[model samples]
Target chain A: MAKKTPLDPAAAFRVPSGLAELSAIDPAGTPIGPQDKESGAAALADLGPDLAALQEKLYAGATGGSEHRSVLLVLQGMDTSGKDGVVDKVLGLVNPAGLRLASFKKPTPEELAHDFLWRIEKQVPAAGLIGVFNRSQYEDVLVVRVHDLVPPAVWEPRYAAINDFEQRLTDSGVTVVKCFLHISKEVQKERLLARLDDPTKFWKYNPGDVDERGYWDDYQAAYLDALNRCSTDAAPWHVIPSDRKWYRNWAIGALLHQKLTELDPQYPPAEFDVEVEKGRVAAS
Target chain B: MAKKTPLDPAAAFRVPSGLAELSAIDPAGTPIGPQDKESGAAALADLGPDLAALQEKLYAGATGGSEHRSVLLVLQGMDTSGKDGVVDKVLGLVNPAGLRLASFKKPTPEELAHDFLWRIEKQVPAAGLIGVFNRSQYEDVLVVRVHDLVPPAVWEPRYAAINDFEQRLTDSGVTVVKCFLHISKEVQKERLLARLDDPTKFWKYNPGDVDERGYWDDYQAAYLDALNRCSTDAAPWHVIPSDRKWYRNWAIGALLHQKLTELDPQYPPAEFDVEVEKGRVAAS
Candidate 1:
């Protein structure tokens, strides 16, 4: 028996080789829109055809009715790490009816009073729907660990609790793909400064973001903990490099396209005879 | 002003004339195979370019971040009457991230305990997202009224409640398009019987649907009341003669295209232009 080699963060994860057999284009390598297009709109324009075909597949998978599979795509990342952009781009390929997007922020007083996962559970998509968590349960680890918001003992158990929660979803037939958009600390500082300089974007910035930045190393350590503990075959974590928006979108789109096509739901078998239909046609 | 006619069951209200537009083809056309030369699929194949253009328009509207306009598309009809099909076809046009779909079913214990509109509020899409309601709050007027599930005094108030709901959504800049897929009783009978006779479709049929059919006249009256009371400048009803599935798909697709174009959201004033460099663009 051969021992499997551990994954190296520096190496690109091998793209599943059989993906090309599923569709005409590789979502991962495909630069949407005109090749040299610099604008988001231009890039988005390039995405239309692949997105449309993917949406058709998604809708067919959803409405075929026999399959009970659900999917939860979780995007977790630092501020301005392209989580929103990922939702904006990758979900472009899905049927909105089949998708749910939930963005989590600081817990409200009511939310804090309950178990951490309470509000998160309500947002889960029912069978045949895809739920996207812009920020998710792992915030308990990332935020609480960095800010020391909860006493260590209270927050520590949450790492295990979340793992179990996601495991349950996967066991119940949810294709859970979690991505952490990794950006350099220098990038974060630049974005925060930009937010402050622009009045129109002032609403998006906070003095608190800088405070959080002071603990960047702490958050990364916590993230490493969560990822190592929760990466199961049923729901694996893909670390998306965020220095490039195009690459991030392509990677996430490829991941989702791969998972959905694997579900392969076809129309239910027809029961009525065409000859009977011909008879009715003749009588009519 | 012209003198108003007194209400009469036989002739007081009119089905919107827009339904006739769908009949430019046929109200009772059959489905065609993908490769068939004269098939409906062949005609719809041309929608690809139209759909791609619609995607660009949708992304443009959403990014503008304007709160001045919103749009909600509501789909309602009998079992197998093509409500799901319409959603599958038309919603495929918009960017999925900018769209939301809420499917209403039997009121949960929590929902039944409140004003009928309570559960609905949480499901309303935020501004910049197109919301589609598969079945909707109109259930109080349609189902509860048809089945006498609630007393007249209880369910009757819902008509006004529903009107107020639409008024608020519109006042807040949400354009509402409600569609009822209208198929004659004989066509419905054929569909229902098809479901009963087919093993694959057995899961979709409900014994109660047969029970409900006994009250077809009552259901029609209920839909009439709901339609007349709820249709307003803010949210008008489009009745689609749905005996022809292809026409239903096309009509609903056109209506959505029209509504979103009317919404016409533009990009919000530039808030961040951090060098606006390739992927490195940030706020500062």
Candidate 2:
């Protein structure tokens, strides 16, 4: 028998994780087990320890480092996909100074008149800051796609534009991590019903959500297309199966920590003479 | 001699913690502690544990309850006050999903045309969320007072409008915690200088801050007046001394947690049928 070779880390990295499979409109079945040979589950678990270490690195870096390369995490997910929960948990790990969030919804008439990206661009983190976008420009893709607010041809061009845009950001040193939380229709229905029954949640139970729910298949198809086209080496999409909130949080946090540590932003190179700093301090 | 009386917690809380006394416009008179203590040292310490607890409560509440009341924390402060640092630290403690941030700046021509509060209203927290405003509607007072943008008569009416707006919110169960990070002019200059001298922080340094510093006396007078008049029983203003970044974080965190815990939004009174919940799960 021929000798079986072991998997190398680089080769393993190239094999798309279950994240990609889940992101597809029609995902192929994969075997699941405690060891998680399945790409999605393993990728999700892989994020844990790296997330913890990166979190510690970020906190220390924020307080002690003069120049920190800030990161912005943008999450776009379907209603039941758990954007809020993901954000709350993942960001809990980073230092507060280094993290901020902007959640975008239906823009007013004034917002509509301006370019779609205008309001979003203003929300990006300045250098050395981390900004998270709960629903980002991809809204131009998913929401716009589902609603047909923009023609197919119009948004078709946007895929390349978005890829270029994200690449520019990556080149400029903005580590952009994007996640699309994927949940099954059955799970979504249960959540919707929960929202409807509770009075406090009645505020969140928009009649519109029901209307939107009818078009679930369309939305799923739209998301798959967006993921397939927009997913790039620069800003890869992690399609998280969020039927489990705990698993989702761990996966997202791990992905973020991995991307940030890879960037490895360093402390400011210039240092002041201690005596001079003291003298300047005294003078002030 | 008559027995000396000791201060109670409420009485002690009123004793000012020697914050203002420690703040001298001149560094020569300011006591240099391990960390910058002239302004924020005491205030931060007071609020730290409370903020930590609030973060945990926010997560616990988010997970267990089907319904949660969203909270908005507005931080309005003078230039040298630690608004950014406070946000950097206090927000550091919470689950990110529960938090959103809006940092109001010079309004665009579009923003200027609308009623000032229109933009702010859109930023308010949704049910079960928390929103933070770096600078808010009080800008109508702070900037207007200093710049004389509107006549006193017009601006004065806003105080009533502001009170009514807040009352409406409290009546609807929206709890607002507003903090004014108070720092002395002397401390402001030291931090501003630190920004100037450090290459990495140079981006944060604006010549405009110096120009504004020239008007320090005018701005301080305006804030004191606004704080006195607008600080209401419903949404009382906590004037946090912010010379020490760590202390400021703690005080602001503590104040917010105390307020949120007091609100104590619980699970809705109506119970969900276990069978129905199970059926919904089964159907999914």
Best by DockQ: 2
lDDT of 1 by residue, B262-283 (tens): 4554434434343442123332
The per-prediction tally of clashing pairs is: 10, 17
**Model 1, range A189-261, lDDT digits (tens) per residue?**
6766666566445545445565577677778778777777766666677666665677667656655655655
lDDT of 1 at B179: 85
- After superposition, which runs of candidate 2 have C-alpha atoms over 4 Å from their true positions? A1-83, A95-176, A180-227, A239-251, A261-284, B1-70, B114-116, B147-161, B193-200, B269-272
User: Relative to the unseen true structure, what is the C-alpha lDDT of residue B244 in candidate 2, on a scale of 0 to 100?
Assistant: 60
- Every candidate's TM-score, chain A alone: 0.77, 0.77
lDDT of 2 by residue, B208-280 (tens): 5666776777777766656666666676665665666665665565556656666555434334444454354
Quantify how close model 1 is to the true structure by its C-alpha RMSD in Å: 9.6
Q: Give the CAPRI rating of model 2.
A: incorrect
